[model samples]
Target: MSATMEPRIQYAKTSDGVSIAYATLGEGRPIVFSPRVFGDIHLYTNVDYRPPYIGPLVERGWRVIFYDGRGTGSSQRDATGGDLNRRILDLEAVVEAVGSDRFALCGVASGGPAAIVYSVQRPERVSHLVLVNTFAHGAEYFESIPSVRVSRDLRHIAEDQWEFYTLALANALNAFSDTETARRLAATIRAGVSPRAWIAQRDALEQIDVVDTLRSIAVPTLVVHDRADTIGDFSMLASKLASRIPSARFVATDDFARAADEFMREGEAPPTKEEQLPSGTAIILFADIADSTALTEHLGDAAFRTKARELDSALRAAIREDAGTAIEGKLLGDGVLAVFASARQAIEAALSCGRAGDEAGLPLPARCWCGRPCGRWRALRQACGLRTVAIRR
Candidate 1:
């Protein structure tokens, strides 16, 4: 099945009444993906789209679960304050919702610490544990890296100077140079929670210390780290974690996603050409100028063609920004057709196209519709030519 298929968003309430938002994709052995504090289930699933880490697993028939913790994304706000211990309940709620007796667990970035604690406490429930770009102890991580300390100190500025703080945090997160990615990361962070809540989440994350419990985890484990990660010194952290956990395997590479793929594939031959292309389910988007005929009549063919080219460029860029793949085909003479990993992403891309077109002075307006049908390239081709944009799952 296609890894880009739109996952149904669902809510799971924690013991404390905080609602956690989660989504599941594919069908097979369940793998719970523990997200970082700023990670949004909807946005990250769309942003990374076919994420290198999870896509291969999904393609191999593993069901992937993604959830947003309290005070972030579609989850409930943290009116009760941030508690590191309570974070475990978020995982528990998601696991319960998935109705799985045992499953593999993958944690990324800040989500690693919680995953470690959960695996240690509930060893029977977690069949395998994978941690990427994370630390066992947050305090040690900050102390080990001076830049991290400086980043933590910047949280004090988040509430008063959110824009500046977002830029600084994005830089600290190693996103400053990639302007588009940085902007999107900033938007995800902003959409997740208020500036004050960001501070609380950071503080809670900093307080995490699971070093004492590392040895207690009995499940098979893999620790992957990027040697050149600017965000954290994973070289030291990965080695320390691997040495502490009994029978744990440690891998050091520049690409966390590739490391994950290797760990999952385990010496299997590379996938063939047919296996490379996505199949099964996907979300498709089609967009065009709302009144192209009238605009063309008024502006004449030459001017209208120029405007059409500009609109197409703007729309393509927007779709790419949202990690949507724009299909190469003619749609209503001057429209755009794209496929996203998620319906939420398709909607976001359509909205982004409208904004981009407006900014570029193109008379393009976009709308979105979603549905689910089963077919392949021919169906997608037929749908792409529609005057109105529609998303089929």
Candidate 2:
């Protein structure tokens, strides 16, 4: 079964004399794959059940590197073991040993924070970075997310039966796999690393929070995540990461695990315009008239339609004068949806429209808006459903 190809696995000694084991495969620009805390990098190489994107990356003629962290797999455990900082240095050691000063880095899940840290600390050594299903800080507001658990709770559970915890860790990491694949993953862990180490490693993740570390990274970065992930909402995390890194871009997906795989392989670059925020320091607004159908019936189509036209005129004038972009005000039965750029401008436009409605002795629909320091008005626009226009001030 292992005969078709053989990976040239080797051992390298870090400055601390810890023997780090790494396997280099394929041939092209180096792409180092840093798995999540509970992940086995070797699993990407095992064809019996390889990850979806790993084989594809190999087929694309990219050189891929996979190595165990200091405390896991074939790498010797750090006697003076510490948290992610120490682990990150371990990665640095490996990168130096690999003899390439710069390469593309693919970090998934918990490892993502470390990748950013490394990129910032060693900017000249990274060409591009891919962060999938990652977090920037301690998952303080992420308790409601199902993929993660409270550190104290996991610690308590691990203290009692480390072996069960190891198996559980393996199962949790591969939660989306089919029954047979999950079984194989569990077996692989049981044979690869001890229960004690797994527990220690799991405990280490509790101390990681890299929110401040991401800012210094200047390399081009891609952040991908599942739209519905319980791991603190990948979209939110991606947004945070992308916002901080000057050259970072965010990509949202519905599949939790597959998104990570696709990013590791750089699967297809999203359509050019879709790859980034439409504008920097700008806002988007959406305003929808309330109870349009009922309003139409109550006012009679002719009168309601007249009121809508008046409202549209007031909205368009206010938005354009303020440099706000507007979607055509369309009547949906008895309601209208309008978009704008600036929060204050949208609010001003809505309030002005209301004044026009009042002059006609009638109430318009509802109105709301949001603003940001960075001027990315989208989050607010989505939340309040309003169109936005950019204001010069």
Candidate 3:
């Protein structure tokens, strides 16, 4: 539950006059994190999310930078523009502000497209490129994800039930197992944007197609995806994207954090024990009682045991049906731990488990110290299930 300390927030001015908030942290060669809509600088600087991706680099003397693109986080909120070229203005502002003549570029999820375009335009400055759980073309995402159409997607949900949307996204990303982390992500997202602004901004960013730009990249590139990702055929598409790049060679590894490290360390010697390859991550789920003793005293041991067993059985059935691995152990008699492959599967199965507990008349509850852990698990799950791609040289 611990995380990297939050640095002082600094501002960068985009050509559009949007003031981007960013932080200059760590040491060594520089690496810039492209912006994400769901998270701001506050979320990334937390324990769960940014550390696994940036921590090892920091220790190895890499100066990693993080920033808010515009609509989300600490940046200008009222102007939630969806134009891709305009978004890159935010990136340009950050790079100029830091004055790092050369640096590596890493992009994850929705953040990748801008980073790709940026590298293409500034080939001389961007030394290496890393893309994780992202796609080359925006349309591929819409076509691949189940039941997600251009007319109906996150924007619609953001309008009707913004809080619910945030929680659901957290569960999908977190693997539906970590209740606490999901709650925290939900809170962070709720704070990041309003329903109106989210819809307004997502109009353009819903899908960031850059198929034509892939081959234009001159830097060494790493494109990573999880083979097990059940978010449609996004992994396959990612591999195809990597193949388009002349300088890119594909790889499959659970420890791509190491792949990223080694790729970024292109000019350096062999890797040491100090840094670790990023591993394929997954989310875990559990059902726990807030006060087992109190409930037991009220229900009587025999009746409580019978109901608990029934609830567990129902939960396990849902897990099996959804193709998730239910871990058997004593997380406590009333609790169960399960692993899921996809965000959609995890969310659906967890909801079913919650229903089982309710139907069995058991009051189960647990709170978490939410920060970055929730989404990290989900991102890991997504990456592990999708295929992985790294630099050729």
Local distance difference test values of all predictions, in order: 0.69, 0.57, 0.65
Which model, 1 or 3, shows the larger TM-score? 1
- The global Cα lDDT (0 to 1) of model 1 is 0.69
Clashing pairs for model 1 are none
For lDDT, candidate 1 versus 3, the one ahead is 1
User: Candidate 3: what lDDT?
Assistant: 0.65
Regions of model 2 farther than 4 Å from truth:
1-5, 45-50, 77-82, 141-144, 150-152, 170-181, 226-233, 253-393
lDDT of 2 by residue, 1-393 (tens): 111134576776767667767777678878886655543455544433333344335434567776767666667753434367766776777788889878988777667767888888888888888887777765542342344663335656665675555455544544433345446666666554555665566566656777777777788788876444323455665676678877677788543234433554465653222223225344443344556678668765533544454454444445555556444222333333344445676677666656655654456654554333335544433444434333122
- Report the lDDT tens digits of candidate 1 across residue range 39-132: 4474545532123444445544578898888887778875434556777888899999889999988887778888998998898998889987
- What's model 2's lDDT at 197? 63
What is the Å distance of residue 390 in model 3 from its true position?
35
What does candidate 3's lDDT look like per residue over 64-94, in tens digits?
A: 7988878777888876775678778988999
Candidate 2 lDDT trough over 10 residues, lowest sum = 270-279
Q: Highest lDDT, which number? A: 1
Cα error of candidate 1 at position 14, Å: 0.8
